[model samples]
Target: MKTVLKYLPALTLAAGLALSAIPAMAQQPAAKAGAAPAQPKSSPAAIAAAKEILSMKNASAMYANAVPGMVEKTKIALIQQNLNYQKDLNEVAQVVAQQLNGRQNEITEGMAQVYASEFTEQELKDLVAFYKSPLGQKLITAEPKAIGLSMAFMNSWAQNFTETVMGAFRAEMRKRGKEI
Candidate 1:
């Protein structure tokens, strides 16, 4: 559990990215019988377009904006997992922050693969153009704040949901006159 907690931030980011890809993958049309399987890497044109889209979205900057929140959340988890390591908390957080930033290129590369596979080169170009537009830029700027708010809301909802579920479980146990 402690080891899991230590890697929680990376896992969370990875899971979030992976989950976001699901809808994109689902939206793709089914290939005809005997069609070639999807390749692991995209074609050069698609890769170029994906990079442009990423640039237009300022993907790295957005992740950097999100880092503070990630750091704070990780700090809390570390404290919970290692209460006796108060003196090393700051150093640990600094190291985590550095590691997260260092991995941004790898994350962006994975994202580019997802985009390239899910979208044609033309589609990626269109997306890049849209992101370069004012409205798309507005969304890009707003996304980090939206993500933070969404996380907070989900956390609160989960707490309430857990309490509700546990209450129901206790009621059922009492009804059965079961002692624990």
Candidate 2:
């Protein structure tokens, strides 16, 4: 489980980049999690275009901490379950982080492969052209904040609606001569 968790970020980075529908390069070995699901055979031109697209999107930010974060999260989880090892785990965290340094490319490469597989050479080139345009630059700059604000809005809406639903339930229950 620990080993699997260690490599999960690579998979997550790949998936996350795809879901972000914007970004960089990333890939890993099969031992990472499992055999990567087969990707469509992309032409060299397509792959190169995809790589350029990812670079322009600054996809590295999406995965730069993945390896270190994995190490830290694992260390914390271990320390919690083995209280006696807390000190040792904390001491080893830096060593672990160092050892795993540079592995983020694994994620970025896989992400690039995904983009390459999903888009044809022409499409990837078109995307690169778009990203190079002023509007594309604006999107790259603004999308993350937009996503953050959208999430915040959704959370607030859910919280308020949850309270409204609870109030409605309570009112219905009261008419039935019960208090909740």
The candidate that wins on TM-score is: 2
Whole-model lDDT, model 1: 0.71
TM-score of 2: 0.74
lDDT of 1 at 92: 82
47: Cα error in model 2, Å:
2.1
Candidates' lDDT values, in order?
0.71, 0.74
| Candidate 1 stretches greater than 4 Å from native | 1-24, 27-37, 61-107
Task: Give the per-residue lDDT of model 2 (tens digit) for 1-180.
Answer: 344344443433454456745432233333445666667788888878877877876667667888988999999999999999889999899999998899988866776687887666887889899988999889777765565555567668999999999999999999999999
Predicted model with the maximum lDDT: 2
RMSD of 2: 8.3
Candidate 1, backbone clash total = 0
lDDT of 1 at 32: 81
Task: Estimate, for each residue in 72-122, the C-alpha lDDT of model 1 and write its tens digit.
Answer: 787988889989986699788888787776655666787788778877778
RMSD of each: 8.4, 8.3
